[model samples]
Target: MKFQIQRDRLVNGVNDVMKAVSSRTTIPILTGIKIMAHEEGVTLTGSDSDISIESFIPKEEDGKEIVNIQQAGGIVLQAKFFEGIVKKLPMDTVEIEVHSHLQTVIRSGKSEFNLNGLDVTEYPHLPQIEEDSVLKIETNLLKTIIRQTVFAVSTSETRPILTGVNWHIENGELNCVATDSHRLAMRKAPISGGNGDKSEAVIPGKSLNELNKILEDTSDELEIVITENQVLFKAKHVLFFSRLLEGNYPDTSRLVPAESKTSLTIGGKEFLQAIDRASLLAREERNNVVRLSISEEGGVEISSNTPEIGKVVEEIQRKSTDGEALNISFSAKYMMDALKVFEGAETNIQFTGAMRPFVLRTTSDDTILQLITPVRTY
Candidate 1:
């Protein structure tokens, strides 16, 4: 295999593929990135069994040549050394050639390095997904949905299924939900090409976070394909695949109350700042509890009291309230996380009771809902 490519283009491709490379993977070949030069372009792939990323750089985009292929071939290069070499190459172009016995030479300007390459034939093949159950969504919208819910996924592996964000598509609507038993987040958007087929999948939060970094912040649409155990995200020149979690996600629909006893709307920034200031004292208490007192004429006050430290109280003017007055205690960190996803001027919070879960939604968008369980503090 021999190819001379633009240094900058190669660097971007290598960086994108490296997101899936991990040295501790059980599969030895997965530690290296597969480089295949075909007639159309050069394909670079990285995988660790759980997640796989493939980035393709065409020979020429528009009127300029990106890769000048001398001979079409393939090789598996160690990701650690190859990644470092591409970034440090001091030239406009890089020359790579693999001889017999898997000996590879990389050259740029006045630098030359010889590294032993592995057989690309030994790399595991990516699962081929049929295009039957596919969905297309805007890149920016997908990123928004992820940010709005991915934070709520459980960091612990106790439930396993709680570590992934549950996705449901039906009736031309797509809903993504994540919860860690204490707090939950749900976001919905209308899918462009929904076939009314009811399907659900649990995708690892870690995979979505990595995909968010690789996706471009644009309005371009991307296609998604899902099978029983694998999911594929196809962008313009990049493809992301991840293994789905095997456990059945718990049914959480009943957790959201259909009616509320107390509800109010407050300025998002003001409420966020109030909780932020209150959390400073709660941080020393270990539980990070913040209390909210709502009254008919006293407005709203957010306070946190710690035995070892002083207390903090902030009064925030309510935009509107139309239900019974209530007092509740909850984690300030969880409340702030739910508020950060709101891009509106105000947020609407509905409380079922002091002991029940409360729901938060942006005043402007009913499509996104965030819920957090209140702490039992008398």
Candidate 2:
């Protein structure tokens, strides 16, 4: 296989596919990236069984030649070395050629390197999703949904299912939810041409995180296809596939409260900063808990205490408060994460009681909701 590609374009394509390349894998070939040169363009693929990514660099795009292919063929090269070589190449173009014995050579400018390549035939094939259950959403919006929720997925492997985010589509809305039992993050957005079909799937948080990193914040819409066991995301020349978790995501609808005993609206930025400050003191404690007290005089008090570090107290004015004055203790980390999702000027926090799960959301938007279970500061 032989091809010449623009240095910058080659570097970007390799880096994007490198996200799926695992340094250590049971199958040694999985650690290498498969490069296929065809008449149309050059394709780079990387996979680790759980996730696979394929990025295409066409010969010409927008009347610019990105790659010129000759002797179309395929080769698998060590991802670690290939990525480093491509990035440091001191030239405007890179030339790659593979021999019959799987010997690969890369040349650019005055630098040239030779490495042993593997037969692309040995690499595992990516799952071919044929079922047409697909949905489309803006790339930026999808990234926002993943960013707001993926952080809440469980880090432990005890219940493998909880390590993934639950995605449900119904009534032309896409709901992404993630929880680690103690806290939950949920984001909802409307899907174009979406019908009220009830479809549920669980995708690994790690996969979504990788996808978010590669997805550009563009106005272009991304096509999402869901099959029985795999979810595919296609945007322009890139294709991302991830295996779906096989267990049912726990029903979280019941966890959100229908009413609140206390409700307060506060500046989102100020509230987050208060929690950030309090967390420093609370870090020495077992739960890193911070206490929030809604005052009858229309302000909220934020405080935290540690036996060894002493305590901290601050107050922020509120938009309004109703129902009852309440004091609740919860993890400051959870509060900060929930606050990151709110883009509005102020956030509405609804507390059912001192011990119940409270909800935080923007005052003007109901599409996004975050729930945090208060830590029992007994």
Candidate 3:
């Protein structure tokens, strides 16, 4: 392989693919990035079995040359050294050439380095996913759906399925749900260009988080294809693939309450601040529990206490209170996380009882919901 590519574009493509490279991978070649220089462009790929990412830099975009190719071939370079060298290259262009016996040469300006490249053919092939049946979603909306739910995925390995977010697409709408048994988050959005095939996939939370970081914030549409065991996300110049979790995600529809016994409408900012302050004391406790008390006369108070630490009590006004007066305790971290996604909008919280799971939603939008189980306190 012989090619000269713009330094900036090469750096970006390297960074994107590097997210999937892991040194601890069992297959030695998986720690290296496969670089293929073809007639059309230069393609870089990285994978660790669970996730694979490929980024392509076209030879010319918008009539401007991005890569100048002299020969067509492929080679695998150690990701750690290649990534570091590309980032620190002294010039605006980088030249790579492969000689016999897999010896590679990298040059930029007056700098030169020789690397022993691996056989690209030894790298595992990515899953073959047909794109005929795909759903399209706006990049920004897809990121929103991930941010609104991926955090709620269980960190524990006890129930492996709980470590992923469940995605269901049907009826021209997509629903994403994640839960850790203590808290749940759900987001719904409309999709386009689907073949009307009902599809379900459990995507590992870690994969979605990484994809969110790589995706640009734009109105451009992203293509998603879910097969029996692998999921593909295709964006401009990038392709991401992840293995679907193998177990069936637990059914969570029945967990949401049909109705509420106590409901409170409060300023999201005020409630978040009160809980944040209260958590300062509760932070010393095991669960970081904060207590909320509501009075029939529409008074609201947040309090937290730790015998070793001090107690914190704060009063916040509610926009409206309905149903029964109630007191409930919950993890301060969970509440704060849910509130941050609301983006300071007015919040409506519905509590079925003191001990039941409570739901939170923004008054302006009903497409997203957050639920947290109240902590039992003596």
Best by lDDT: 3
Candidates in descending lDDT order = 3, 1, 2
Best by TM-score: 3
lDDT of model 1 at position 39: 88
lDDT tens digits by residue: candidate 2, 200-312:
89999999999999999898999998877999999898999999999889999999999988888888988888889998889644668899988776578999988777999
- Residue-level lDDT of model 3, residues 263-322, one tens digit each, is 999999988988988998886446899999998887899999898878988889889999
lDDT value for candidate 2?
A: 0.90
Model 1: residues with Cα > 4 Å off, grouped in runs: none
Q: Each model's TM-score, in the order given?
A: 0.97, 0.97, 0.99
Count of clashes, each model: 0, 0, 0
Clashing residue pairs in candidate 3 are none
Evaluated against the true structure, the overall lDDT of model 3 is 0.95
Clashing pairs in 1: none
Worst 10 residues of 3 by lDDT: 278-287
Candidate 2, poorest ten consecutive residues by summed lDDT: 191-200
Q: After superposition, how far is residue 79 of candidate 2 from its true place, in Å?
A: 0.5
Error of 3 at 119 (Å): 0.5
- Alpha carbon lDDT at 291, candidate 1: 96
